[model samples]
Each structure stands twice: as structure tokens, then as C-alpha cells.
Target: MAGHSKWANIQHRKGRQDAKRGKIFTKLIKEITVAAKMGGGDASTNPRLRLAIEKAKGQSLPKDNIDNAIKRGTGQLEGVVYEEVRYEGYGIGGAAVMVDCLTDNKTRTVADVRHAFNKNGGNMGAEGSVAFQFKHCGQMIFAPGTDEARLMDAAIEAGAEDVVTNDDGSIEVITPPNDLATVLEGLEAAGFKAEFAEVVQKPLNESVIGGDDAMKMQKLLDALESLDDVQEVYTSAVIDE
Candidate 1:
């Protein structure tokens, strides 16, 4: 089960600061631009753009801001030419780590990412070094109190590959990347809100490294997420309280 173990929920519960919000907005803006550039700016005609726009809306971003991002992406307005990047590494106790980034300059971004890992007592690795431990999967986390039977039926009908629920009432609805939007819409129509909805690099098996080690790993993850170029961070570190 994905549970409430998603990093976003934890970060929210921790009460992110104004600076953190800015960072999040930056990442969201980049996503909107990239999605628009790849697909057309027409959300109805572009599934990826639709999903990105919905995500920006969920974040409460101003409509004008969203439109501007789309314009920039579609070349109606000039914008930074960002590049996507991924870095693999291991945190304390050999916990696999993955960092996703969007940058205008790969050289600077790589340096910043490497420094983040080294400063946090972790070290970045070559491609495929740690990625082997994870599988790219579409993960949709359900909000609390959603009806299990309804969710199960809807997920299955929406082409979800699996629906796993934790004892604490959190549910993880998994699907292929192609079916993520379909599954999310199905759940929404059934009146279920998602806690987290995105394509994630899920670990095939988890590793628990709590206490001091967990804290260290969190610091490393935090540092990476704090970087302006970073878009997401994934790790095998276990979180249960």
C-alpha cells in the first residue's frame, strides 16, 4: 500500500515554509511548460497537458500564471529551454535514491545535485547504479475515508493494475502510465480525492532505515528537493509511525 507514506504528505504535515512553496511552484510551472510544449496547449486535445493543468489548478495557482506557462511552452511567448534530468544514488544504509530535475543548464544542475548528495553524507552514482532497484509505476494515493469497495471496483474498471490499501485507511491505486489519467478521473467521478497522483519510481522491495539513519536520509532528500532545478525525489526509505 502507498499509504500516507508519500513524501508530499510528510512535507505538508511538516508545514513547508514560504521558500518551499516557491520551490514547488517553480517545479509546477516547469511541468506545465514542458507538458504544453510536448503536447499542444489545448488541454481537451492533449492528455498530458490536461493532467499538468489539473495539477496546477489543484495547487491553487492563478489562472493567468497557468496560461502564461502554456503560452511560453507553445512558443507564443519565449521561456527558458529547460532540460529534464535524473540522478541515481544511495542514502544511508544503502537506501536507493532517485532525483528528478528540470534545468536550463545540465552542467550547473549536475554540480548542485552532486554537492547536495555529498553534503548530506550521501554520494551520487552513475546511471543505473540504483535505478535497478525501482520500477516506474503510476501511483495514485487515495484520500482518507474513501469507500474501499467502490474504489476497488472503480479502479479495476478504470484499468488499474492493482489497488492496495493499508490498515490506516490509505489506499494506493496503481496503473500503467497510459492509464493514470483514466484511473484518476474514474476515482474522482466516484467522489474520491487523491492524496498523491503522479508517475513514481516505486521500489520493487522496500528497505527500512529509521532513527538516525532515517534522519540523515531525509536531510539528503530535503537538500535535493530544495534545489531549484529539482522536480522530484524518490527513495526506498521507509516511513511508518
Candidate 2:
């Protein structure tokens, strides 16, 4: 799950992933297979695949599993044929939410997603209902107290679209979705590594929901993310973390 304002702290998020490693691995495998399928099996020639592999490695996914997923994607091995699907909805306080999924059964996936929203104080939205509120872009977030000046220079040279320093002092580097890997490599080479980096549906603006509403919003997000077919969940809701 990803949030724009007052996003979960990096360490806290990492801890959550550690607790849900099994589910995380399942999602990562699906991502690797889908990436390889869409962009061939060669990571060196496919930016999406390269990024997917990097993420898998970061999570300690086994080499054999990664290799097998790639082979399955390239049709060298048989695997479930999956299709990509996206669902949009409104959460507590009507904050916009988007869920990205990869599934072999669209009927089951949609039903699960709709059920999640309906049961979690959220309402499912039609296609394009809330899409305009987001920007599909690459995002890299650096911990606070980094050398912003140096990072800015590096980001510019790396072809990043924008560099923003949030009120909390965390830095955000934005790039075209396709340039994520290139920009990430350049930044790392320049001694500015991000704590989190990925292509995502970034909210154009955030809607702050606090107190009871915040808890409800989080529950809604967690419900959607818990779906097996859901690969990612993005929301415009900002909650006290």
C-alpha cells in the first residue's frame, strides 16, 4: 500500500513486510512473471524486468524461483496465464483509491475487489472515476537529512522529472515511469540511495483524514491489499502515522 501525505515510515513499513513475507513473495513472483512476459526475459534489455528482479532480490526471493518465473513468462515453462486489472474506489472521507491486480480469473478478481471495498467503508468506482486525480510516474524516496543539494544535481543529470523536499524533510524524486531504473542507477552511483523506489500511481494532492476516519481508511486499504490478486494499492488518503 502507498500513500501520498504522511506515508508510513520506512522502517515501520519494512517491519510490516517482514511480518507478511509470505504474501509479499507471492506478489513479487507475480510481478516478475508479468514483467518478464510483457518485456521479454532478458533483464539487461528490459527495464521493467530489471526493476522487478531488483525488487525480488531486495525481498530475498530465491534465485530458482526468479529463474522459473522468468522462464514461465517467456513460455519456456507452463504457468498460469494472467491478465492485468485495475479498480478504483473511494475510501473513508471519500479519499480516492486504486488497486492494481494480476489474475488468471477476472471474474474472481473483480468480485474480491468489490467485496473488499463494500465491506470496508469504501465504495467501488467505475473506470476513470478517480484516475484523473493521480499521475502515473516513477517515485524514489530518500530518508531525511540527506544532502539535498547533491541529490538534486544528480537527479537532474539522471533525467528525473522533479525533486521535491517534503515538510518532514524526506526527499522525493520523480521520473517518467520508463526512466525509473536509469534514474535509480544514476542516483545510487552518485551516492544518493532511495529507501523506496517504484513506478506508482502518485496522488496529485492528498486528502488528510485523521482520528477515527484515519483508522477506517487504513482498514479499507489493508482489506484491498490483502486480496490475493491485488499487486498494489494506492490511495490519496493521508492519515496520521
Specify the highest-lDDT model's number.
2
What does candidate 2's lDDT look like per residue over 1-241, in tens digits? 2244433655555676788899999999899999989999999899889999999999999999999999999999999988999999899988999999999999999999999999989999999999999999999999878898999999999999999987777889999999999999999999987899999999998887879998898888878888899999888877776
The TM-scores, one per candidate, come to: 0.91, 0.96
Off by over 4 Å in 2: 1-11
Measured with C-alpha atoms, the lDDT of residue 122 in candidate 1 is 91
Give candidate 1's TM-score: 0.91
Span of ten consecutive residues with least summed lDDT in model 1: 9-18
Output the lDDT of residue 218, model 2. 80
Per-residue lDDT of 152-214 in model 1, one digit per residue for the tens? 998888789998886457778888876688888888887788877887888877776667887
